[model samples]
Target: MTASSEARETALLAAQAAADKLATDVAIVDVSERLAITDAFVLASAPNERQVQAIVDEVEERLRQHGVKPVRREGVAESRWVLLDFVDVVVHVQHAEERAYYALERLWKDCPTIPFVDRAAPQGDAAAPGTATLSADDIDPASADPTPLAPAPGDGATAGGGPLQDEDPSAPEAAGR
Candidate 1:
C-alpha cells in the first residue's frame, strides 16, 4: 500500500517548501504501509538551529498556502528538530547534528521513498551531466548562504558560501577558470 494521492501531494509540497529554505537531503517516505495515522513523511535537514527554524517556517507557510495546516508540531523551542504533522503528511526538519544522530532514513529504509522534485532546481536539470553536483555534506557551513551553490567544487561555492578555489588543477571548469 502506497500513500494516497492527497497525502503524496501534501508531502511533496512540504518537501519543496523545505528545499526553498535551503534545506538539504529532502526526502519523502511513504509510510502508509506501516502507519495508520499518516500516509507519508517529508524529511529534510538544516545546517543549524536557525536554519531549522527557517525551514520549518517556510514549510508551514507554503503548506498553509495550499490550504493545509499542521495538526500538531513538536521540537520547535530547541530548533534541533521540528516535526510538522499535517495528519495526512508529516514534515521533519532536523538540524545537521540531529539528522546525523537520528538517521531517519536508516530507520525507514524498508519503506519505499516517494519521488521528490525540487522546484528550486530547473525542470529537466536534475544537475549538470558529468559535473559532480554538490550536496549538503560538501557545504562549508560558514560559507554557503548567498553564494550560488553551483559549478565545480573548490570554485568558491562553499556550502556556507566562501571563496576558495578548488585545489584540483585537473578539473577543467575550476582549474581553467
Candidate 2:
C-alpha cells in the first residue's frame, strides 16, 4: 500500500520546514509498503547539533501550525539525531556526522522518494528549491569515505562492522545464577 494523502501532506510539510532551516539532503521516503509504523519518513541533515535542533524545531512548529503534533520525540538531549513521530509520518533530523554514518536513505533505497519544492522559492531558478534534487552527494562529503569505520574504544562491533553502541555504565547488567 502507498502512503495516504494525509501522511504525504504531513511528510511534505515536515520536509519543507526542514528545508527552510537550511537542512541538507532533505527527502521524503515513502515507507508505508515496508513499515506499518508510519507512511513516510522525512530525512534531513544539518552540519552541527545546533542546526539539527533548529530543523527539528521548525518541523515541529510547522506541523503544529497545521494542527498536527508529533505523538513522540526522541534524541533531543544530544541533538545528534532527533525523531519526531507524527503517527502517519516520522521526521528524522540528524547531524551531518550521524547522518553519514547511519545512511537512512541507503537503508530505504528501495522505497520511492517524494519530490519536494519549497513553496517559498521562485520558479525556474537553479538556486530555487524545485530545481534541486536530493542526492547522496548533498548529504555529507564523509559519506563517500572509502575506509571502513572502526569501532570506537570500548564499543562493541556489530556484524555490519559498525560500532554496536557505547556501553552504558548506568544500565544494570543481566542477572547471573
Candidate 3:
C-alpha cells in the first residue's frame, strides 16, 4: 500500500483502540481532499461528561503511544464536546447529548464513513454502507430538545431560554460544527 493509505489505516486503528479503551461509539470519516483541516475525522460519543473526558484521555494516550500528539484541544472544560486536533486525523469525543445535537455523520453525509467496530462486536460485524444500526445505547435522552446545556451558576445564562431562535436542524453546525 502507498504511504498515505498505510497512514490512514494506522490512524483508524489507533482511533479504534482509543474508542475501545473508553467504551465510546466511534466513527471515522475520510475527507482527505475535501477539507483543509485534516484528512480524517474520528468522531466518538460518550454517555456523559465523565465518559467524554475519559474518552478524550484515552484517545490522547493511545495516540501519544504512537508518537502522534494532537496539536490542540478544545472544549475540554465543558466536556460537552472535545476536539483533538492531530495534523492528519482529528478526534471528536462528545457527550451523548452533544453528539445528537451536532450530528457529524449527517454533516459529512457525502463523505465515506469508515466502519467503527466496537470491541464487543463479533468478528466481521464492523459497519458497512447502508447497514449501520443504532442501538438503544447510542441514543441520548437529553438531546430530544434543542436547548443547550444549562451553564453553571455565575455563568449568567438564564434558564428557559429555550432552543436558539436560529437553530437550523438541517445545518451542519447543528450537527456538531
TM-score per candidate: 0.71, 0.70, 0.64
- Candidate 2 residues 101-163, lDDT tens each? 999999999999888877766667457663455567577544566555666666556434433
Model 1, 1-177: lDDT tens per residue? Answer: 889999998898898888888888889999999999999989999888999999999999998999999889999999999999999898999998888999999999999999886765755566742223688998976576655555574345644343344445566665555
What RMSD, rounded to one decimal, does every model reach?
11.2, 15.2, 15.1
Clashes of 1: 8
Q: Model 2: number of clashes?
A: 0
lDDT of each model, Cα atoms only?
A: 0.84, 0.86, 0.71
- Index of the highest-lDDT prediction: 2
Judge candidate 2 at residue 1 and give its lDDT.
89
| Pick by TM-score: 1 or 3, better one | 1
Q: Give the TM-score of candidate 3.
A: 0.64
Candidate 3 Cα outliers beyond 4 Å, as residue runs: 1-3, 124-177
lDDT of 3 by residue, 1-177 (tens): 112564476567656765566645577888776787577888888788888888788788877887888789999999989998887788888888888898988898888766556554445546542234677778774665556667665553334433344566567765563
Worst 10 residues of 3 by lDDT: 156-165
lDDT (0-100) at residue 56 of candidate 1?
Answer: 96
Model 2, residue 78: distance off in Å is 0.3
Is candidate 1 or 2 superior in lDDT?
2
